[model samples]
Target: MFALLCQLASAFVGAVIPVFYSYKTIKKPSQKSLSYWSKYWTVFGSFLAVDAVLSTLFINYFIPFYEFGKLIFLIWAVCPQTAGAQFVFDKMLAPFIHRHERKMDLYVERMLDSVFTNGPTLALMVN
Candidate 1:
């Protein structure tokens, strides 16, 4: 019961509120709104990735208060007063991404080139 409630709260905070604010941001473009949502989505994506990997690896293990903790974190992240997402992105993610962005871009370009060049061949092989 508690876990289910936590899930509901998390979804509302993490998804519903952002979506509402995102629509508002789209309607009225501003530097502040744009910056906040960008940071929110970046942090949200990072959280999802980490959660997915950890849950997959520890499927059987029980983590006490995980859902509640997640909800609290989401609240903190989305709350404008705290601006946790912005802080996290600026302090952590940005530097790491900046350091390896070139390498990542090169890999992505190579992958895309391969896909475009070998697309027909790959399709034929699949069939």
Candidate 2:
């Protein structure tokens, strides 16, 4: 279960590639329409998708092979499959994350501006 949790968390992190990229590519005014985010997003998503399908098929498609099938898959597919996830995150996910974080900073700034301007005004009126 721990390993499974790790896998899921890692996969989710990998999936964040496009979303972060989407945020990053949009956050910066000068970096508009960059393919870096989209291309890597698609690649990681593809790797994850294909790995899942293959793993499922490997497990169910050959019932006769049973656990033996899984063992073979463990060696041939599992490591690479998960490794691909890590690669996607390390290679593609981190870059976009910075951009997303920039967007978050903007959101926080807007929210703070609103709060600072309105909160004190409301407090004074109430007093």
Candidate 3:
């Protein structure tokens, strides 16, 4: 039960909390900052989408797996350690991101291009 809650919280924190950090890091809302925010949201949203699908499948198919002590491992993702999410992103995920940097960039570019090119319906929802 506790671990289930932890899994839920982990997904929320991983996806939503980064926006706050991005805001804090950017002192001004210049073109660069705005673009940075857009990219940040894009990447985070993509990650969250993938995570939701995977977690749903796992929870549905592997109920017994979550019943054991293995669930404690999720704490690394859920708990905000002293260094915080940025540290984990930089130290853990960044390398993998860099390895696939071109693909990520292409995906973000195509996604943003499509969104901005279309009518402003989705834009309003994002705002």
TM-score of 2: 0.37
The per-model lDDT (C-alpha) reads 0.91, 0.56, 0.57
List the candidate numbers ranked by lDDT, top first: 1, 3, 2
> Model 1 RMSD to the real structure?
2.7
Candidate 3 — which residues are off by over 4 angstroms? 1-50, 56-58, 65-71, 78-91, 119-127
Per-residue lDDT tens digits for candidate 3, residues 1-127, read 7667755665556545655756665765677546544554544555566657866788635665452322243333334454333444566566778899999899999999987887498677789
Query: Which candidate number would show the highest lDDT if scored against the true structure?
Result: 1
Which has the better TM-score: candidate 1, or candidate 2?
1
Report the number of clashing residue pairs per model.
0, 0, 0
TM-score: the better of candidates 2 and 3:
3
Per-prediction TM-score: 0.82, 0.37, 0.44
lDDT of 3: 0.57
Put down candidate 2 lDDT per residue, 1-127, tens digits, no spaces. 5445545555445545346646766787344245444545555566557668877777534455443433343333223344443455567666776669889789999999999989999999999
TM-score of candidate 3 on Cα atoms, chains taken together? 0.44
